[model samples]
Target: MKNKKPKKVFMNGAIPPEKIANSIANHQSKTSIGAHSIFLGQIRADEIEGKTVQAIGYSAYEEMAEKVFHEIREAAFSKFDMTCAHIYHSLGTVKTGEICLFVFTSSAHRKIAIEACNWLVEEIKAKVPVFGKEILEDETHQWKVNK
Candidate 1:
């Protein structure tokens, strides 16, 4: 088995840029990786009606979310020749312009890395049961719809 266990994907708040940089820096030792694809999902301040979004309050069924994430990883590995993959998502409130999701994939070639990263994001969005509350500026909120 290439993967041993399911990795924890949930972070306490927003995903930090430093963490993303360190992830790339850490892979310097892996000389076999020729390409890396990264996807960062940031909270957008979309104006709905007259109010603008301030932040997103995210929640999920942890047990099932982790399982689904692991399944997605396994499927990606089987489908693409990836060297390593990592995924992280925010759990509490993430303000506008902050990152809530990060997906990284590395491979010997560019296409595989890019394809795996995109595929993982799509699968996670479609399959994982993570819910997001779009908090508006007026203190009202609405459920986020992944489009």
Candidate 2:
């Protein structure tokens, strides 16, 4: 019998922008997609109630996060005729007003790309093992879970 290859999920503790972009561009070459849609999650400095959030620190439980990410990729592929997808989420720390998650999906049509991109991002936020610490401008902080 032939050996089987294990499924690979593009996951990392700290994601770099160049690598993410490279992955997307490389994945795109595999299929002649007519359109690609991308959604990025960025940090925001805002008050939660009355305390101002100066920055955010992101941490993830990687084992579970990988599982969730793989599942989302599979679902997107099965649900749409997508050429490919690339998802990267910050694991260590992400400051406010900076990108923390990026989802890029490509398909033969723009609609599918747009829909899939949106779906994947929501899934990551809800299902992945990532947590956020909202830092107040005064230097105090608190943990925040996206609801």
When superposed on Cα atoms, how far off is each prediction in RMSD?
0.8, 3.7
Judge candidate 1 against the unseen true structure and give its global Cα lDDT, from 0 to 1. 0.96
lDDT of each: 0.96, 0.73
lDDT of 1 by residue, 1-147 (tens): 366599999999999999999999999999999999999999999999989999999999999999999999999999999999999999999999999999999999999999999999999999999999999999998999999
Stretches off by above 4 angstroms in model 1 are 1-3
lDDT of 2 by residue, 17-129 (tens): 77667866686466678988988777787777787876777766667767777877888788888887777777556667667777888888999999989888888777777
lDDT of 1 at 81: 94
TM-score leader: 1
What's the TM-score of each model vs. the native? 0.98, 0.81
Show where candidate 2 strays beyond 4 Å. Answer: 1-31
